[model samples]
Structure formats: structure tokens, C-alpha cells
Target: MNFSITRLEDWQQVVDKILPQLQHPILLLKGNLGAGKTTFTQFLLKNLGSTDEVNSPTYSIVNEYTSPKGKIFHFDLYRLKDLDEVYDIGIEEYIDNAYLCIIEWPEVYEEELYGMKFHTMNIINSETAREISFE
Candidate 1:
């Protein structure tokens, strides 16, 4: 699925359509800085029945949230230098235990998920709006 949004409220529409289509626990978000990755997540978690505040996990690496379904672990792997750094942070254990894992800047660890099933959402931010592609 793909979407183009000019306003923040538009995120809800995108979230509504994608929520039902979310079959896997792992969701890889790809986009440049300030491209609304975290904004998208905030909407997603709200629709998923979460009451916790959502923020970028850039420095913390991971943030946890709760929902009627189960636990959600949101990760930001942009700061990590390599796979070793990813393993040192216990990325595998988090994914193993999470009900859902939303990873932003997942390039470093993406290959590690070779045969696993996961969803990918890419956002392209332009001067006027943001374009999103989900699969």
C-alpha cells in the first residue's frame, strides 16, 4: 500500500488502512530524518490501543509500549555502527519477546532477518508532503 499526506491528521487514515494489514510482528520503517517515522508510529500505537506516550528512540535504541494485543518494542538502529553493535544491544532477544517490533533505520540489521517475515514502510519527505510505501 502507498500514501501521500500533507497534514498530521492524515496519519490516522494511513494507520487505519495499514493496521488491519499488519500480519507480522516486525515492521521496518525506512526514511530520512524528520520524515514522520515516529509520527506514523504514534498513530499506529494509538490505534493499537496503547495509552503510553510515543517518542523517537534514537538515543535509547528501544522503547516499550503496551496494548490489548501484547507488548510492542520500538527501535531506532540508526546510531549503531554495525551488526556487532546491534547484537550488543540485545536486538534478537527484544524481537524474540516482543509482540511487535517497529524498527526505524533498519538497514544495519535488516539482512539478519533473511528468511523471517516482516513488513516494510518507506517514507519519502518532499518540500510539500510525504510519500509512503508499505509492504
Candidate 2:
């Protein structure tokens, strides 16, 4: 489904509508900064019944949250200078745990994404609003 989010509230609505239909364990949130990527994630985590604060994992590389269904792994690769950085962070171990992984700054290792579901979002301002796409 596709969504056109004008304000922050609109983005939240998109997340609310999409969260319940998710059947995949992995979601690749592709978008530039200030584009509502993390904001959408916050909406998702909250709707998933997570009470913990949802912050961008930029400095820490990864942030984790737990819900009744499974662990949610939020990863930021913006600081990573090399593909090996993913390995150095024990990504394999995380993937093995069946956690729901939400990746930001995925361009760095976009090709490295294998054996997982793919979802891309872009903030489009051409129409006097932000546009988000999901497939």
C-alpha cells in the first residue's frame, strides 16, 4: 500500500494501518533524514505494545525492544564505514534470533540484504505532502 503523509500525524496513521498487516520479520525502511523514517518506526513499535522509548540507533548502531511476539532490532548503518561493520556488530547472531529487524540507512549494505522481506519508503514533497510507499 502507498500513503501520502502531510504532517507527523499523517505518518502515524500510515504506520497504524500497515502494522497489523505485517507478516514479515524484517522491514527495510529506506528514506533520507528528517523524512519520517524513525518517526514511522516509533509509531510501529508503540502500536506493537512496546512501552520502551524508540530512538534512532545512530550512535549505538543498534537498539533493541521486546514485545510479546518477539524482539525488535533497530539498526542504523549510517556510521558504518565498511560492509564488514555489519559482521563486526554480530548481525548474524541477531538475525538468527527471529527478531523483527528494522534497518535504516540501508544503502550502505542494501545488497547485503538477503533472505528477508524488503520495504522501501521515500519522502516525496512534490505534491505538497510527504509520500510513503510500501510493497
Candidate 3:
């Protein structure tokens, strides 16, 4: 799916459309700094029935939240320098246990996902709007 929107509330429309299409546990979010990746996540978690406050996991690396559906682990791999750093965090264990994992800046760890089934979304920020491509 592809979407282009200028307002933040439009994220809910994107989330509502993608929510049912999400059949995998891992969702790789690719975007540049200031893109709406975390913004999209907030809408997603809210639509998933989560009441917990949502925030970007940039510094913490990972943040945990609960929803009626199950546990959700949000990850930000932007600061990780290597795959070893990714492994050190026990990403596999988290993915194995959580119902869903929304990973922002997934480029660093995506190679480890070979042979794994997961969803991918890319957000491109343009002068006028945010463009999203999802699969």
C-alpha cells in the first residue's frame, strides 16, 4: 500500500488500513530522521487497543507496551553500530516473545532477518507531505 498525507491524523487512516494486513510479528520501519515512523507507531499502538503512552525508543533502544492483543516491543536500531550490538540486546528473544515488534531504523539488523517473514514500511518525507510505502 502507498499513502501520502500532510497531517498527523492521517496516520490513523494508514494504521487502520495496515492493521488488518499485518500478518507477521516484525515490522521494519525505514525512514530518515524527522520522518513520521514513530508517529505512525503511536497511531498503530493506539488502534491496537494499547493505552500505554507511546514514545520513540531512540535512547532506550527498546520500549515495551501492552495491548489487549498482547505484548509489543518497539525498537530503534539507529544508534547501534553493528550487528554484534544488535545481538547483544537479545533481539531474537524479544521477537520470539512479543506479539509484535515495530522496529525503526531497521537497516542495521535487517540482514539477520534473512529467511524470516516480516512486514516492511518506508516513509519518505518530502517538502509537502510524508509518503509511505508498505508491504
Candidate lDDT values, in order:
0.96, 0.79, 0.95
Name the candidate that leads on lDDT.
1
- For residues 37-113, what per-residue lDDT tens digits would candidate 3 score against the true structure? 89899999999999999999999999999999899999999999999999999999999999999999999999889
Query: Native-vs-model 2 lDDT?
Result: 0.79
Name the Cα RMSD for model 3. Answer: 0.6
What are the per-residue Cα lDDT tens digits for candidate 2 across 52-73?
Answer: 8999999999999988778989
Give one digit per residue, the lDDT tens place, for model 1 in 26-106: 999999999999999999999999999999999999999999999999999999999999999998999999889999999
User: What TM-scores do the predictions have?
Assistant: 0.98, 0.89, 0.98
- Clashes within 3 Å, all models in order: 0, 0, 0
Worst 10 residues of 1 by lDDT: 90-99
lDDT of 3 at 39: 89
lDDT (Cα, 0-100) at 83 in candidate 1: 98
Sort every candidate by lDDT, greatest first: 1, 3, 2
Off by over 4 Å in 3: none
